[model samples]
Target: MKRTRALLIAPVAVTLLAVTACSGGATDGAASGGDKAALVIAQGGLGDQSYNDLANAGFESALDATGISGNTIESDDVVGQGEQLLRRAGQSGVNLVVDLEYSHNEIIGSVAQDFPDTDWVIVNAEAEGDNVASVLFQEQEGSYLAGALAALQTSNTDDPRINEDKVIGVIGGTAGVGIDKFLVGFIQGAKDVDPDVEVLTAYSNDFGDPAKGQQLAQSMFEKGADIVYSVAGGTGAGVIQAAEEANHYAIGVDDDQDGQAPGTVLTSVLKRTDLAVETLVQDFADGAFPGGETVSFGLKEDAVGLTDFEYTKDAIPQSTLDTLDELRQGIIDGDITVWNVVTDGYPDFYSGS
Candidate 1:
């Protein structure tokens, strides 16, 4: 856990092959103490207390429990430095590599070929290689449930937080497919409940700027939006804060953030990046790494879903929870189909994206 960082190398954009299991490992016989791994932090960096932090938690857990040694590499310029870092890990003989940055997906594929012995994990998107395992979360599936809950509560006058308006909103950190996945599913679920519900959407354009997120969320709240779902990583923290200050609702993503502002944060769209990291490390140690396959974590895997709402469960009636359970089952059984921007394309409402 306390080791010197590998020396920095001048980064190059040279073409490389898809990485993973190219040969053996930096240390073979992982259970026998030859296992070690590396985790690449995403663009927003760690301490956002959301995606990057969760991924690091998993990597740290694997290091502690598996008796394997590893290091977490953080970079302000992840895209510019990603290639060099991957190559560095391979050359250092690190047995496994896990990359959390979405922008690094293609780079991982191109670089994996150079390190046949290293097993690599790429999150949020797919990459192909004999030794590469792609981890993707079904974010849309979780967002749909969040939308359903928000829409139900938006029009209720019983709770102080509830307003007279049937309007809900969502703010994304970016306008790309990644965040759109959450927005589309959310809109679909809201429409499923109340076809006339007015749903507003916007982009923060930055994941780590809480001030900007707060400003955007406050604007939505002032416009009669009673609840908002934030897919804006660290930026979403401000959105939650805005909900707290305005006595509205903000649903969290990637982690259990209901406790962030107590009653203000309705629930979090759970995406288990930690479980993915821990499992992949274990699989590599056991020599069962499924390289070249995109493994998706969805409702069936319990990887992407809504939280138990421990803080606000009493506010949500049994009927609402029962409906959610029915929807959940229908989704798992194919009876209820949630819109996925990644797979199904953008919906009619957001055709401009």
Candidate 2:
């Protein structure tokens, strides 16, 4: 979940070669007016493909369409050096600075005040400033559906991947509010569907440590877990890898990672960071940037949801899919309200996120 939302971006063990230029902005143009923006990438950097890469893709898409001049600044120590980067971007005459680093949420308030003219965007968390906007996703809604599907599949004896165990599991990147948002929703979804179901939860402190993710997931599998959902960033990759090796099912997060390991992955919780960035740029272009406000991307906004089970749809029963569709519609229609960890606070399951 290096998705700035994870807010706990650990260093991924990968190399990123971002295209650069003299202005420290991404190539393709010179620094201009409102078209000029800065994206400060969160931890795990650009090659993460999940969080940073998705956000960058949206920025690039905006640039392609609007001719916006911008660059993504990657930092190894996003929490430590993010303020300095934000200040530099503001000083460089960038009209809008969208920070993909969650650690910069509180810092944005102070920084925005220093440069009242420059508007700011903070993802996954909230901050108060006349020039700052917060971007939040309904991860809980999508995760709830994932939990429901896992529960249905786990209870199905007809599915080869499932057994008689009414048990499932989730591996979180870290025990933070961001990670718990996914876990709490999943747990709620499972309990609501099947009260007797048990969800085993664990935390892989390092988002980039796939080995730890694999080890934790293997332990869950040994203890009767048929489907294991992972909220870890790069670490989730390890969980998926373990599922493939064990011939069990794994749930992916952030992107449509169902195809990553074909049928091994059940589904991915869509964060829609791509859409968030694209909309932010579009709003800026339309002179409607919601500065000093917060924008939420939920099921209603189509900002978060599940995939169409592209690679694994055939593996799922039609009845289960129909139930899932009902649950999704319920959420959209407000008949089923998924908890928001950031807004509604943590539930009893999470204790205190």
lDDT of 1 by residue, 1-353 (tens): 44443434354533222222211223333465567688888767778878988878887776666667777776666777878778877888888889998877888988899888788999988888888999888888888888888888776678889888899999988887877898888988888888888998998988889999999999999999989888888999899989999988899989889899888888899988998888888877777888988888889898889999989888887788898898888888989888888878877876522
Report lDDT (Cα) of residue 174, candidate 1: 86
Model 1 has an lDDT value of 0.82
Kindly report which residue stretches of model 1 are placed more than 4 angstroms away from their true locations once superposed: 1-30
lDDT of each prediction vs. the true structure? 0.82, 0.81
TM value for model 2: 0.89
Local lDDT at 254 for model 2: 84
Query: What value of lDDT does candidate 2 attain over all alpha carbons?
Result: 0.81
